[model samples]
Target chain A: EDQVTQSPEALRLQEGESSSLNCSYTVSGLRGLFWYRQDPGKGPEFLFTLYSAGEEKEKERLKATLTKKESFLHITAPKPEDSATYLCAVQAVSRGYNKLIFGAGTRLAVHP
Target chain B: GAGVSQSPSNKVTEKGKDVELRCDPISGHTALYWYRQSLGQGLEFLIYFQGNSAPDKSGLPSDRFSAERTGGSVSTLTIQRTQQEDSAVYLCASSFGMQETQYFGPGTRLLVL
Candidate 1:
């Protein structure tokens, strides 16, 4: 079965501290890996999409890198505004035209 | 340029009642999707509409859940005989095509009392 798992369910960091969130997946064939940031009570906001291994994309302080079996979202010197649930999802080729399998997001809290 | 939009930002209904959620995708988008998200959980794919066709209804959890897209624009997701387990945020998303990046709307929060 195609599935995605995100680790470090919750993380608390002081302002300026940085960390990485993990998303591991097993799919029939990887079409794309996506990262999103969601604030409470709102839909996820698209962040980055990595289409292949060794692929990386960045926006603001978030950088996403993809591998054959997993993806990593690395946060650079974070701030309080960067505090939000980071979600990871994957689109499998077999399920290519249909849906996205999402991971239970990582709740990140950065305190100033 | 508006993104996707959903009706009834919040809905509260008694158990066994029926409810309808609506989604208006960005103009010209060819694909739309509906997803359910339980509190503090990941989003679950419910259904999707490509143009006027829905080739996959297998993502829907039960027969009680149904969706339709009209004129290749707006979409509606209806839940019949709502149960407490049906309480969740129903989110709508759209993309230029089935394989493109999806843009989501602020979800409708549904509460089954």
Candidate 2:
């Protein structure tokens, strides 16, 4: 079975603190690794998609990196508004179609 | 809709009642998905639909939960004999296809009291 696990279930960071959230996976074939940010009542908003190992992408304060077995979402000098549950999902394209298997997610709270 | 839209932003129902949640996908999207998010479980995949083809219901929790998509657009997820365990925010998302980026809606919060 394909699985995704995110670490540090919850994270607390003071303003300007930098940290990284990990998402380890065991997938047959990786088509893409997706990152999303979700608020309390809203659905997840797309963050970044990494298609291969050693690939990195960034937007604002969030940067996503992928390895063969895992992915990391690095936050650079985060602010309170960056607080939310960050989700990690992987698409097992080897199985055909883009069926994404998602992890429970990492809740981040950045306090000022 | 400019984005995926879910109906009844908030719903409170007594246990044993049946409820229907609606999802209207973005225009021209061929793939749609439903997921549940709870305080403890986070987000879980429920079901997925692609075009007018048969849906992939593999992720549905039980027979008590069923969903149907009509005309390859709007979808309705029906829960029978809802239990307190069913309380969660049900989210809907859509993409151009299975491989495209998915855009999500403001979820429908269902509280089974």
Candidate 3:
């Protein structure tokens, strides 16, 4: 079974559109939840990390929130450049030092 | 100071050939990692390096896969007699310490044809 699952495998939106991507995880012990943005032909870039439920972080048009069982990445008034695959990962406590289990990311396309 | 940097951004080699990918982490970082991402697939942890201690090679898929870190900075992941299944984007990242946020480099995309 997939440890992590992301919904809406692909999404297309017009410029200034707002939407949210969901990431659900089932792990032995969730040490942290991470959100990343990846561009074509490039490595994934870190965006935020939430450790506890009800925790949230924001940067520009991107905001990530975490619950006990899932996490949400909300993009508000997104621009065309915001188009990219958004990845969610979990750091299991049993796995130490930079080891991460990632989900098949959501491919987001923003049209102008 | 610059972020993590990887070399040979793209490589295409015949099956059974050897390939080497390099990663130079930011100055003063103590943790380094390697991950593989196939097309339409999520990232797969390959290895981890922390300080000068023995590396965590548990994530390595096979004996043909191995990596090394020198001076606790730059790292190299080598695939011996690579198979078609080894083709993927190999990503490297460095962090200040264990459990810290990691900064990634633009990965090396390897295609074993």
Candidate 4:
């Protein structure tokens, strides 16, 4: 069974549209949850790291919130440059500290 | 400061041929990781190295895949008897000692024929 799952395999949004991406995870001894943005033919760029329920962090127009069962990446007034795949991952004590189990990702396309 | 870097941005090899992928992590980072992303799939954990401690090899898919970090810096992932199923984008990441945040490299796209 996959430990991490992401929804809306593909999402198309108009410029200035605000939305959220969901990431549900099932893991024992959750260490942390991570959000990343990946562009074509490139590695993932770090976005946010949420460590516990009710934890939230924001950068620019992006914000991440975490709870016991899931995490969300909310984008505000997104620009075309924000179009990319958003990935969510988790680390578990069982999997050790160095490995990250990633979700299939949500492909987000923002257009003007 | 530079982030993680990988060599041979792309590689094409024949089945049964051996190939080596290299990763040069951030200068002072003590933890390095290797992952593979197949077409339309998520990143798969492969192996890990932390300082001088023995690596965590549990994520390696098969014995044919092995990696070694020399002098706590550069790492090389060697795939022996590469198979078509091995084709993927190999990515490397690194973080500070025992830290949870890992920054990734651009990745090396490997294609097996």
Identify the leading candidate in terms of DockQ: 4
Each prediction's TM-score versus the true structure:
0.98, 0.95, 0.96, 0.97
What residue runs in model 3 are displaced by over 4 Å at the alpha carbon? none
Candidate 4 lDDT by residue in tens digits, B1-113: 99899998999999999999999999999999999999999999988899855468887899999999999999999999999999999999999965569999999999999
Give the TM-score (vs. native) of candidate 2.
Answer: 0.95
Error of 2 at A31 (Å): 1.4
Q: How well is candidate 4 docked (DockQ)?
A: 0.86
Query: Best candidate per TM-score, number?
Result: 1
Candidate 2 lDDT over residue span B1-113, tens digit each? 49899998999999999999999999999999998888767578888899866458877999999988999999999999999999999999999988898788999999999
- Report how large a share of the reference interface contacts model 4 reproduces: 0.85
For residue A39, give model 3's deviation from the true position in Å.
0.6
TM-scores of chain A, one for each prediction: 0.97, 0.97, 0.95, 0.97
Candidate 3, residue A21: lDDT: 100
| Winner on DockQ (3 vs 4) | 4
Docking class of 1: high
Better of 1 and 3 by DockQ: 3
**TM-score values for chain B across all models:** 0.98, 0.95, 0.96, 0.96
State how far residue A28 of model 2 sits from its true place (Å).
1.0
Give the runs in model 2 whose Cα sits over 4 Å from its true position: A94-96
Per-model interface RMSD values are 0.9, 1.4, 1.2, 0.8
- Candidate 3 deviation (Cα RMSD): 1.4
**lDDT tens per residue, model 2, A22-51:** 999998888889999988878899999899
- DockQ class, candidate 4: high
